[model samples]
Target: MNIGIVVFPGSNCDRDCAYVASDVIGQSAQFIWHQETSLGEMDAIILPGGFSYGDYLRTGAIAHLSPIMDAVKAFAKQGGLVLGICNGFQILLESGLLPGAMLRNRGLSFRCEEVYVRVENAETPFTNQCHPGQVLKIPIAHAEGNYYTDPVTLSSLQANAQVIFRYCDADGQSTGPSNPNGSLDHIAGIRNAAGNVLGMMPHPERCAERALNNTDGFLVFQSMVASLKTQARLTAR
Candidate 1:
């Protein structure tokens, strides 16, 4: 699996995602700068987490119009898999690839911690390796992670099964305290209508190693690789 890790001006997790791709997933990750016009035959793309454009003009606003986004959109329109973590998630929302918007944390502070995430829709490519209700530990680090959308949008999201992950307690259960950002409906992640693109606040790349005391995130990436592999095989047959 050749992965392309997108690196915007302030992307802090690009190397981290690449580290996991090369070391754990055993695939070389090519870093694609934000100004690049093409994805260059990549199997998948990851928009790593960080305060893009230093969070100026609101999170992900300036970065949304980056030159590479057009190519990124083209890729996703073709059913290519895209995973946006943290600031990447914000970019997705800004780009209208995913529904909803992020707001300043209800507490108004940067938060970093390991939290449990319940897999709500494993039927999608991102989390297809896990079963519904399975709990995974993923780290979330962000200052503006509170997710919000209007009633109509939220309803449509629910109707489409786009809500994929929710915050959970240490026992793998949902609670107000466990959901640090107080996102409506405890949502931690969501997918595009087509289910090929996913944007989640949690950093799965950070949780890819057991020695890091978390490996739950790896399955989701592995799941995508597996799903794409199966689809390719089916098409070839």
Candidate 2:
């Protein structure tokens, strides 16, 4: 599978994402500058974690207006896979590609640590390699990772199984201490209703290698590659 990792001016993790996709996952990967108007022939798009545009007017507020995001939205409309991590998740929310908004961490501090997120719905393209209720220990680093949405929309997301990952303890229990950013309902990640787009606060690319002593995050990228392979086979048939 070919993956495109978007790079904004302040994007620090684009290369990290590319490394995981290409070296770790054995998939072709390329960097897509934010100003580029075309996505080319990529099968998957990743908005890697970073403080885009210095996170000036709220995280991702300015980056969403870049030329490439329009292409991303269109690609997602066509059922293409899109994954956003950390500040990328902020951009997705700012672009309105995924519902909800990010607020400052409840503690009013930047957090950087390994956190556990339980797979809530593993049937989607982004989480297909994970089983329901599987706990993944991924690292998260951000200040505005707190996720919030209206009550009605939250209920709708829950009803539709759009809630894909939730903050959880090592034992897979959602608890107050387990939520690093105090996101609503312990939401660590979520997919769009179409299930092709996913936005999450964790930095899976950081922990995807066995050398890092944690490979739990590898499943997320593996799942995307698997989904693309499945799509290719179905198309060939």
Candidate 3:
């Protein structure tokens, strides 16, 4: 699948996403600047982690207003796939493309380390390669990564299998200590109601290659590619 990595000012991970998509995943990829209104022929789009606009306002508050978001929104509405990682997750929240908001890490400090996340739902495009309850070791870097949502929204997400990943121990058990950010319900990742958009706080691109010490992140990209191919086949019928 053709992928487009969105880049905004202060977006440090755009290149990482591109490199993973092109070099690691062996897929066609390109960088889409925030000001550009067109996404061209991208089959999927990724909003990589970074302090867009230097996080001048609240995280994701300003970047949500970018000109390209309109296109991204339209694309997602039409069943296009979109993945937002870390600060990109914050942007998706601010854009209303995903539910919930991020809060300061419970410790009131930044966190930069690897954490284990269990695959709560393996049906979504982003996690289809994982087994149910499988654990993935991925790194997270952020200060305000605590994800929160009202009870009503959380219930709906649970009912619809939208909660895709949760912080967990190496054995795939969710526990308080395993939750690095103290996110509500240990949520590390979630998909939209329609299941086409995903927003997660972990940085998958950081460990997508063997050189990164772990290649578990590659499964996420592989899942997307497989999903896209299946979609293409169904559409062609």
Candidate 4:
């Protein structure tokens, strides 16, 4: 599989995502600049974490207007896989690829720490390698990781199984203290109604390598690659 990592002006983790896609996952990876209007032949698209446009207007306000987002949205509409991390998740919200909005952390301070997230729906392409109720220790860094949505949308998400990951204790229980950003229902990640696009606050690439002493995050990438391989096989047949 070939992954395309979008690079905005303030994007700092594009290289990390690229390394995971190419070096660790043994898939071709390329950097797609914000100005680029096309996604080319990428199998998957990733919006990496960073303070795009310095987060001046809003976390992803200005960045979402980039010409590339049009392509991203179109790709997702065509059943392409899209994953957004941290600021990338913010961009997805701003671009309307995913639902909901991000608010300031509970205390309005930047948080950088490790948090455990329980897999809520492991049947999605992005989480197929994980089992239901599995816990993953991932690191999150942001001031506006708090997720919010209207009651109706929340209910819809729950009914449709769009909620993928939720902050939880090591024992896989959701609790207040385990909620790092005070996100409603401790939502750590969610997918679009179509399940092809995913937006999450945690940085999986940061903990995907053994050198980092934690390979739990690697499962996210592994699942994506595995899903793509399965799709290729089906297509060939």
Candidate 5:
């Protein structure tokens, strides 16, 4: 599958995300400029981890209104796959593509560390390869990763199984320290109602290979590719 990684002015991890697909795993991938309005010949798009716009006004608040995001919104509306990581996750929330808003980390500091995450909705495209409640270790670096939603919204998300990933420990147990940002219910990642868009603070690109530590993140990508293939076949039918 051909993947496009979006790059804004402060997108430090666009290349990293592309390399994970192209170089690390040998898939076709390209860098999509932030100003570009079209998605090009792409099966998937990723808004990578970074301090976009230098987190100038607020995390993802400005970048959410970028022109290219229009195309992304349309792409996602068509049931196309889109993944947002770190600052990208912030952007997704700001763009209203994903539910909830981000708040300052409970500690109010930029955190950089590897932590365990448990898959809560493995049936979704982003986690299809993972079994429900499987634990994966991935790295995260961010300051405002605390996720918040109204009680009614949270209940809705839980009912629809949109709650995708949660912070956990090595043994796949959810706990306090495992939560890097003290997020509500330790929500580290989530998906839209359609299950085509994913927003997560953890950096899957950071662990695309086993040599890096754990290869758990690859299942997320592999599942996405598989989901696209499956969707295509279903449409072809």
Candidate 6:
């Protein structure tokens, strides 16, 4: 599959994502600069984690108006797959492609460590390889990753199974201070109602290899590719 990794001015993890996508995920991945107007032909697009525009205005506020976002929006409207990691998630929220918003961590500090998140729903394209209630060891490095939403939206999310991952303890229990960011209901990740777009605060690309000693993040990427393959097969039939 051909993947496009969006790179903004302050994007630091673009190379890391491309490395994993090419060497580990075995996909043809390329960087799409922020100023670029075209996404070319790509099966999937990823907005890697980083401080876009140096986070001058807000986490993703400045980058949301980037020229490429219009193309990304159009891409998503066509039912193309899109994944946003870390600050990219913020961009998705800002661009109105995903629901909810982010706030500063409840600890009022930057959290840069590994945390556990349980797969609340594995039916989506991003988590088809992960079993329901399975805990994944993923790294999160951000200060404003706290996710929040209203009561009605939260209710809809739960009813539709849009909540993909939630912070939890090592044993997969969603209790205690395991929720590093104070995300509402420990929500760490979510997908659009259509299930084609996903936005998450965790950095899955950072631990998709053996050197990371935790390859749990690979399941998310592998699942997306596998899902696309399945869709192609079904379409062919």
lDDT per prediction? Answer: 0.92, 0.95, 0.94, 0.96, 0.91, 0.94
- How far off is residue 152 in model 4, in Å? 0.4
Question: Model 5, 1-237: lDDT tens per residue?
Answer: 899999998999898888888977677999988898998988999999898998988899889988899999999998889999999999999999999999999999989988899999889888989998999888899999999999999998999999999999988888888788989989999999998999999999888897887788898888888888898899899
Give the higher-lDDT candidate: 2 or 6: 2
Best by lDDT: 4
Model 6 lDDT tens row, 67-185: 99999999999889999999999999999999899999999999999999999999888999989899999999999989998899999999999999999999999985899988998
The local lDDT score (0 to 100) that residue 98 gets in candidate 2 is 97
- Find the 10 residues in a row with the least total lDDT in model 5: 18-27
* Model 2 lDDT per residue over 10-114, tens place: 999999999999999999999999999999999999999999999999999999999999999999999999999999999999999999999999999999999
Which ranking of candidates, highest lDDT first? 4, 2, 3, 6, 1, 5
Candidate 6 pairs with clashing backbones = none
User: Candidate 5's C-alpha lDDT?
Assistant: 0.91
Per-residue lDDT value at 133 in model 3: 90
- Say which prediction, candidate 2 or candidate 5, comes out ahead on TM-score: 2
Q: If both were scored by TM-score, which would come out higher, candidate 1 or candidate 6?
A: 6
Tell me the tens digit of each residue's lDDT in model 4 across 60-176. 999999999999999999999999999999999999999899999998889999999999999998999999999999999999999999999999999999999999999999999
> For candidate 4, which ten residues in a row score worst on lDDT?
107-116
TM-score of 6: 0.98
How good is model 1 by TM-score?
0.97
The alpha-carbon lDDT assigned to residue 67 of candidate 3 equals 99
Candidate 1: pairs in clash: none
Against the true structure, what is each candidate's TM-score? 0.97, 0.99, 0.99, 0.99, 0.97, 0.98
RMSD of candidate 1 to the true fold?
Answer: 1.0
Give candidate 1's error at residue 140 in angstroms. 0.8
lDDT of 1 at 223: 89
Question: Model 1: per-residue lDDT, tens digit, 1-237?
Answer: 789999999999999999988898888789999999999998899999998899998999999999999999999999999999999999999999998999998888788988888998989989989999999888899999899999999999999999999998867789889989888888999999999999999999998888888789999888878887898899899
